[model samples]
Target: MENPIFKDMLVLELASVLAGPSVGQFFAELGANVLKIENAATNGDVTRNWKLTTEPADTDIPAYFCAANWGKKSLALNFKEKEELQQLYKLVQQADVVIASYKPGDAEKLAVDYETLRSINPRLIYGHITGYGAADDRAGYDAVVQAESGFMYLNGEPGGGPVKMPVALMDILTAHQLKEGLLVALLRRERTGEGQLVEVSLLQAAVSALANQATNYLVAGQEPKRMGSDHPNIVPYGSVYTCKCGKQLVLAIGDDRQFRKLCTILGAEGMAAIPAYATNYSRVQHRQEVNERLSQLIGQQDREGLLQQLQAQHVPAGAIYTIPEVFAQPQAQEMLLRNGDAKPGVRQIAFKVQHQEQAQLTPPPSYNNYKEDKID
Candidate 1:
């Protein structure tokens, strides 16, 4: 296997929870030496205490903490202490990159703001994550941002109360944005020999993620509504059909050709010839009628046979799977990782990169797991 891309890079992670630490985790996976700094006064990252299951007999580390913090060293310090603050400053001086997720003015209060640290190390790439905009002082948790950014308003069934996504989608999207920005900054620093500040907010990320839904309202003057599992623009694209055996399958008929194939398979050649459903645009205009016809036809067929026939006909279709069913697939097994054979062992990184040696998975540390070594 080849060596990792960022073997010699050093990252100082002053982040907690999901978004900021996730960026550090990405660097760590690429073989960067990431030192995660947590405040000793607060028992380290808040996620360390966010227990999903009861504390195991062997480890007090929460699964939430483990998910985003692996393959990194931990240094816990009280910033209020003169000695510890000095030590942290020294670490900043040696780092190639620094990432933090503090509410509005908290970074300056702790003396870890980008401007202060940049003065110490001119070539240091700094990344800042916020809940709202850089100047907004409101707390920017994922759910709140989702609600504020119009994401929640577009979610859930028609005529039902808005529902927040079960996952921290805004945080995850922000992490990706931060990761991309930092990588670009790192590349630019190599050429210019000067680092820059990169910033991402949960609100910004949520808004950008609006994609076509946002465009529908802005460009077409069509405000979107909750359509449950259906896509706003595409007809039959997000509808889940129940088979005779009670299994659910989702169809994604992208074009007229795929629609015609689907119609042929369902013995609805006459439906396919109808002018109202002849093209994707027309079908979208008559989505209820199209969906009703497809649902009635598909509901009579067995899922496995229907899916096999759909695949053979080049129609995009898939069975709706539960979480366990998804994990049971070979593709999913290849993506998931486990540290050891123990029952509640460390959940390894869920992504993979080809042609690189797998990094050794490290369990998330307890508070102040590593003592500060004097920086030269």
Candidate 2:
């Protein structure tokens, strides 16, 4: 089999939860040797105990902990111990990348700060994930960052209070940011033979992810309101219609032509002729009327049959699926990867980079899975 993209590269993962570990996991998938450093004194990463249900199991490690840590080796160390700190410093000197998500000065206190490590290894690419920027000392959590970054403010239904997203969106986005920065830094290192510090924060990621919402506020002075799933600039774009059987069908009518086609499919082609519904801009101005009319008509039909018809007509529509339904999909099933007969397994890495051989992945490691005696 051919070697992976990062065959000889070594990554030292000093981060926990999602953002930092996720970057390590990504490198592991791409064939980098990722060694995750867990604090043995604290029973390792906190996610190991984030159990979803109260039921007892063979290992206390929860699915949350396994999700982003698959395919990496684990080394437990207590930085407070001089020997362990010295060993970690040795590993840092040999590593190509080091990723950590410590609060402001905590890295310095732990003696793993970028400045110290860079002095030890001039070619080490150091990545730091923060809750805010490098200057902010506040601890960053995904939910709190969601609220502070204006994402929560524009999330819930109209006239409703701000709602935090159910997922750790900020952490996930921050991971991608770190991954991109690290890749670019690695490339530059190849040319200059020197590594640089890369930094990403949940606050910065959340703001950058605003996309058009941020542009609307800056360019048009339009403060976004909570519209639930609705798009701010498009009409008939965010409304969910309940069918006769109680399933929700979401329609994404992107342009006038699609809207006209949807009107025709609902046997309300005349609605397209009305001045208020003729164009997307006018429809946005009269979104309530448009949604109410569409919802009433859509509610009269069965969901599956209507979805089939919509698909046949080339309309952009889909059923709003529950979590189970999402995983049950053929596309989703194809992406699932398993090791042995484990009850649950990690999904395939999202990248579509084709390779001659499939990358093999092992289950997440148990605490202190590797011993100090095994170190070179």
List lDDT for all candidates, in order. 0.85, 0.87
Candidate 2, residues 244-338, lDDT tens digits: the string is: 99899899999999888888888899999999999999999998898899989999999999888888888899999998998999888876767
Candidate 1 residues 1-376, lDDT tens each? 9888888788999999999988888887788888889888997888877885567644546777777887678898888899989888998878999999988899899888999999999999999999887889987888888899988988899989999998899999999999989989999998999989999999998899999998999999999999999987888898999999999999988888998999899888888899999988998899899899899999999999999999999999999999889878987777554566622322235656789886665656666777657321
- Looking at model 2, which ten-residue stretch has the lowest summed lDDT? 348-357
Residue 149, candidate 1: how far off, in angstroms?
0.8
Off by over 4 Å in 2: 372-376
> By TM-score, how accurate is candidate 2?
0.96
User: What lDDT would candidate 2 get against the real structure?
Assistant: 0.87
Return the TM-score for candidate 1, rounded to 2 decimals. 0.94
What are the clashing pairs of model 2?
A: none
TM, every model: 0.94, 0.96
Cα-based lDDT at residue 108, candidate 1? 95
